[model samples]
Target: MASSTITPASLPPAGQTSNFVDPPYIGGKFVAVNCIFLPLAVIALGVRTWTRLFVVRSFRWDDYLMIIALLLSCVLTGVTLEMLNWGLGKHMWDVPLADFMAQFPKLNLIAAIIYCAATGFTKVSVLVFYLRIFPSRNFHIAVWTIVFIAAGYSIASILANIFSCNPIAKSWDLTITTGSCMNRPVFYFANAGLGIFTDFATVAVPIPWLRRLQMPARQKVAVGVILAMGCFVGIVSCIRLGSLYTLLKSTDLTWATTDALMWCTIELNLGIFGGCVTAIRPFVRRYFPRLLGLSSGGGYTSSQSRSRKHGHPLGSIPHSDRVNFTNQDNQYTTTLTTLRGAPDNGSEEHILASHPSGHAKDADGTTGIIRTVEFDVENSSTAPQRE
Candidate 1:
């Protein structure tokens, strides 16, 4: 939730002053949140980049959108830090009236815009990543719908914040007395309310699709837990919304906004962290396979082997997993369905075994009568081919 600043029009009339007492300085809490979460976000995105580019060797639109989100997040974090310098977390009485009048509101306006853009891109990136992995047509439709809604919300938020005050400069420049502003509290509340709604909606979209996948119970549970961790972002948004309400109603904005701003940092950072989790599996499988109960080769385990023998495709792998079967003619038929525009053999394991002679070999050195099932919904009832 973006913190809403009280406009000068809400202040006391001429020859009057607020009776509110200055509260204890708690700006350090804001500083601490930024220091911790921003670096965590950077590290998460950095590892995600390495995992996608070097390990998986598949970089797509989702990654690009995440990069944009990160950039905007950094900009927002920087602006927030700059806000602290002008007494952002101090009591209104403590701040120099000029700094409070000019500097803080300017940065606040900028922060609101950047927050909207960053969050919008983050949600869209997660949805796009879903598109890359899940092949269900219905799921794709849901994801695309959410993408449009998120984009629309962000655009509306940016526009509203930009023109919240007619004669835009008046948004930050309290000296311009003639200009009027939209209901600042209502705008921020609606924006944050929609943000929280979308947060839960994005997390909910994958559940039904995941349940339909034919995976072992243990693996299914593990995968679900990983994705469910995204709920933390939604929870943070709720907390931020509460803090936002407190800040908007508060007479002491600079002091009361500390928690709201801190929660905002967490929400954005956790969004980045959540979006990167599934995509970084290849990196973990490569460097820390034991952590995931995977072997050094990053191939199917014994349970997966049993599942494969039954013609059930292991559900954990992404779209990039490729399988090749060599017929007696020594021609290879790749069975794994890859996403359009992705490199063949780009993701995780190359299930194709090479042989010295002109025949396909399994990993166990079986050189003849290779069996591989083609995964296609249309051909679901077809028997596995032995070649």
Candidate 2:
């Protein structure tokens, strides 16, 4: 029997696959899971974009960048994984996914590059948003500075992933029959360190910036919660670090590294999601009906949300009640009233006396004064009777 000689066209040795790897799924649960995740993310990307277009009335460049990046990354990662699977003769869980993934480090580069590119851009967009929205210059500087550092790390990552070797091909293909390359360990270690820093910076930048927002206390905290979403970013970075060996040596690190890649994808998507959340927060207050409260049916407004605690939703003050009928003082008043009371047949003095002190009519009928000693009850007893 002829031995299956290895060639780029021929599949790798059967059952010699790595258990897990990075950036792309190899087979089994990895393939099934990614099949689900990619479609879901695609669906989410579309739904989120459309929802923002009509409901929020706008979508930012970051949104477009993130959606496009996610799509490209997902498609590349998925297609590459499928091709690798076919190359390996649909190798199953007999070996690690890393064994297969290691076969094409170039694909790894592509996957990680797209993931990092989207994430880096998303973070920068978030920092820009913070700069625009936050009142504190310190917050702006802090966020931008972190973004600057992240940008540096991202650039390092790009260069490292691309040119760490004399010729870039060596980083991906061991059988290139070409120039010698840098040690894989050295490249991966540096990658791990840089990734940790980028992930950390991505997590850290939003805090001070979000905390500095002039929103309500709860909302300020909510804004700060955006940074907390980085928990997944850190998780993926750390997990990949722990599995760095597989990321480096394994051929099919699909399941292991693909999870990491997917996490990174989600992290960037979440950042874009956070932007949408922040931008429409005020709009939510403006247009959305408060589920648990009453309104003059004019719908919710910023003032109603401000006055009422969140345990209850919003209630609007009627337009007539928003201002005082008589401007005795420059205070805001919300008392609904009717102008039903007219001059009685009593003496002009007594008829005039029926009106409250500030209720005296002006020439234009728009403004009035009241000078009456007695008044009829109206909508609420506290509300002045309408004349």
Which one is best on TM-score? Answer: 1
Residue pairs in clash, model 1? none
TM-score of each: 0.74, 0.58
Best by lDDT: 1
lDDT of 1 by residue, 149-245 (tens): 9999999999999999879899988789996899776677788999988898888999888877775555566677666768888889988889888
Each candidate: RMSD to true structure? 10.6, 13.6
lDDT of 2 at 133: 54
* Residue-level lDDT for 108 in candidate 2: 65
lDDT per residue for candidate 2 within 333-367, as digits (tens), equals 22233222221110112222233544634222333
Off by over 4 Å in 2: 1-26, 86-103, 171-175, 209-225, 245-298, 301-387
